[model samples]
Target: MARLESTLMAFRAKNGFDRGIAAPQIGVQNRFVAIHLVGKHASPQEDALPQAESELFQHELNHLVGILAVNLVSKDLLSADELLNRFPSHVI
Candidate 1:
């Protein structure tokens, strides 16, 4: 799509790197993403879709379940007691 390409170009110009971009919900009610891979990254064959799709699906599913990155902090970053005290268990 022209919009997607222009956006990516603008981002690359502002930043110093070009990366993959995903265009979601292109068609009516289509729950699919169109991915554009840039730079000298892994080839389509090398980059397995099954594993990537699984992880992506899991992340999206987490949003539906209300489990976010902030909740999954490293133990080193915050102790169990500190984490529990800082954020309610139910909120996470």
Candidate 2:
């Protein structure tokens, strides 16, 4: 968890995101974290729900990084865990 936090910090710095919340910190169970609001627009109030932010970040990142196929496939009756169980190889 410490290493994950450190890596997330490094990623934020490298991307110039400057946002405090990251995806892996929550329960997204993947390497991608989505950052919606950034820079001066972000605040403590906006960040009150870190888990939601992380989930949203992961959703957006999935879209950006070409996970649409998996997303689409998972949109059916499958729960998130079920989808993951069906395609564990795509997690990273």
Candidate 3:
């Protein structure tokens, strides 16, 4: 766990944009992930729940197989309102 945290920190320091990392990314067979949300925004209180936590974990889990969130988006970009209107809450 300590190594994973340090690896993630080092990666963010070097690349300047990574916020999370899956253990498999560094050859760790353990099922785990390290995430740093220090400078990021939290979900609004109006949300039914803090969706970002679940969403981010799910996003990172995909990295176990080398997949990414962008690979799951089936269409072009859409605004938040558009997404809410087009898909069910679970899909967003």
lDDT of 1 by residue, 1-92 (tens): 56556665778799977433434422323233334443455556774545655565555445444566578776578777777888876455
Q: Give the candidates in order of TM-score, highest first.
A: 3, 1, 2
| Model 1 spans with C-alpha error above 4 angstroms | 24-92
In candidate 2, stretches whose alpha carbon ends up further than 4 angstroms from where it belongs are 18-54, 57-70, 73-92
Tens-digit lDDT string for candidate 3 (42-79)? 55765442567667777888987778777887778888
| Each model's lDDT | 0.54, 0.57, 0.78
| Model 1 clashes, total count | 0
**Candidate 2 lDDT by residue in tens digits, 1-92:** 45545665787778975443334345446655434354344466674445655656656566445564365663458678986999899876
Instruction: Specify the highest-lDDT model's number.
Output: 3
TM-scores for the candidates = 0.33, 0.28, 0.57
Ranking by lDDT: 3, 2, 1
Clashing pairs in 1: none
Cα RMSD, each candidate: 8.9, 12.9, 7.3
Tell me how candidate 2 scores on lDDT.
0.57
